[model samples]
Target: MTTLGNMKVHEITRDYGIDGLSITERNIPSLSARQVLVRLDAVSLNYRDLLIIKGIGRWRPPAGRVPLSDGVGTIVETGSEVQQLTLNDRVAGLFFPNWKEGAVTTEKTHDPLGGPTRDGVLQEYVMFEEDQVVKVPSYLTPAEAATLPCAALTAWNALIEKGKIHPGKTVLIQGTGGVALFAAQFSLISGAQVILLSSSDEKLERARELGISQLINYKKTVNWEKAVLDMTGGKGVDHIVEIVGGNNVDRSISALAPNGLISQIGVIDGLKGEIEISKLMPKEGMVQGVQVGSREMFLRMNQAITLTQLHPVVHKIYPLSAIKEALTELEQGNHYGKICISAERNQ
Candidate 1:
């Protein structure tokens, strides 16, 4: 097996802000039985990383924690008892490693990577249990594979696995970020109509390039809900990818068709939200919060990706040294797709 003597890790300081982020050195850890070592190639940023870095609410972590969730890399070494995974395998760690399959439980959601609960894969090397990581679609680049763990999988769990949406369904997609784009692509494959909402006409035009023609610039159209209803013949949409949380949720409910499902997966507006019960009750609308997904779900998503050759939209790739700049870009929110951090020297 090859050896990495020491590796650089981005860590959080007591300040818990961008200023608190720093680079540090640590010796490579030894592997135990049933464990394998991955030389992480890239890590993709999500809005959740910002929440954790800024110490928002329950996302606050102790000083010296690594903060990142989505990563993809090649296995470099395997422990004696590690049978399922072998060297040179390309894999990404599960967001919720303990939850392999089945429904959500408090215990399953209790601890997640890149948070206060456990250290994330911001470093060059990460060790995982044999089953904690899953192979990704071979057709995707490392950066694209890195985007799957959270955003992409959350989209799949919401619209496909849980929503069970099919052809002829009208899906209202919010924003143009990672989750939104993934939802849009998945909706296209399922033959569902997508009415994407964005404040910028430029981003909406970009979505149109992806073959999603129905678009609305919320900045110009103050009440895009009416547009959604109008496009659906006053019946409202069948599904809503509610990436904008908080009071906007009520707006989503207003645009829901009878028995429609709205997947609450983002907190761009705010963490706290209130819905109009009267509007939802009459429509029989349902709001389901998606917490990523299990390893089993990841496997299934990979299969679909491989079959369709659907690539995750990647806006830009920054080297590890520019993590702060990447995070700042994410805060500015102009990017149309996922922002990624690559550990490769050439990047």
Candidate 2:
């Protein structure tokens, strides 16, 4: 196995100036008895990673390597106790970093890789517990599967697990971020009608080509909630993937039909705020927070992905050296979907 050390990573020094990210060489991580060492082929950035860089997320790495929660790689070595995985297994890191199976808890969610507390996958090599890694589908390359750990799993949990949406149900996905985009694709593959909302009509139009039944340009229609209501002929959507959390909560709640579920997946709109819960009371609407997903969820998502050959929509790719530029593009919201970093290309 390659003992990768003195590797450069995008270190976030401060919150205000993203340019504060400096490339620094650090030691390659070592594997535990139950761990596997992977040479990461690709990594994808998520909105949560941005929040951590911006100093808004719950936790932050005190020192050491910069953090990234999701990446895909080939295992180069397996620990003595690791039986399920072997060298050369194409795998993605678990979202929780530590949580392996069963139910999720505050303890399980405490330290996510690439979040505040854990060092992320931005480095060339990473060590993972064999149980915390899930093999990617054979249909997906490293770059495509790299986007799955966060966006795909969250979308799956939101629509299928929390919302319990079926074929005939109408699903509404807000924003064109990675999660929403994945939700749109997953909804379509499930034979559900997907209404995609985005500020840019051009992006919405692009989603149309991917089996999106309805598109709402929220910028053009200021009251997009009314448009959502109008589309369902006042019945509203059966499932709403709510990415922007704050004041938009009531609107998402309002746009749901009776007993309709809202997957509160993110706080991209406003992090600290209050929502009017009374509106949801009338419809008995349920809003469940989705913090990515579990390993089991990833397995389920992969099965669905392989069955449909559903690949993630990658908007742009950046070589590893241009990570800062790629992150800047993401911060500016220039890309429509996931931004991938090719590690081997730059290596």
Q: Candidate 2: where is the Cα deviation over 4 Å? A: 1-6, 14-16, 57-59, 345-347
Clash count, candidate 1:
0
Worst 10 residues of 1 by lDDT: 1-10
Q: Per model, state how many residue pairs clash.
A: 0, 7
Error of 2 at 342 (Å): 0.5
Candidate 1: tens digits of C-alpha lDDT, residues 40-80: 99999999999899998989998899999999999999999
**Which model scores highest in TM-score?**
1
- TM for every model, in the order presented, reads 0.98, 0.94
Query: What is each predicted model's overall lDDT from 0 to 1?
Result: 0.92, 0.83
lDDT of 1: 0.92
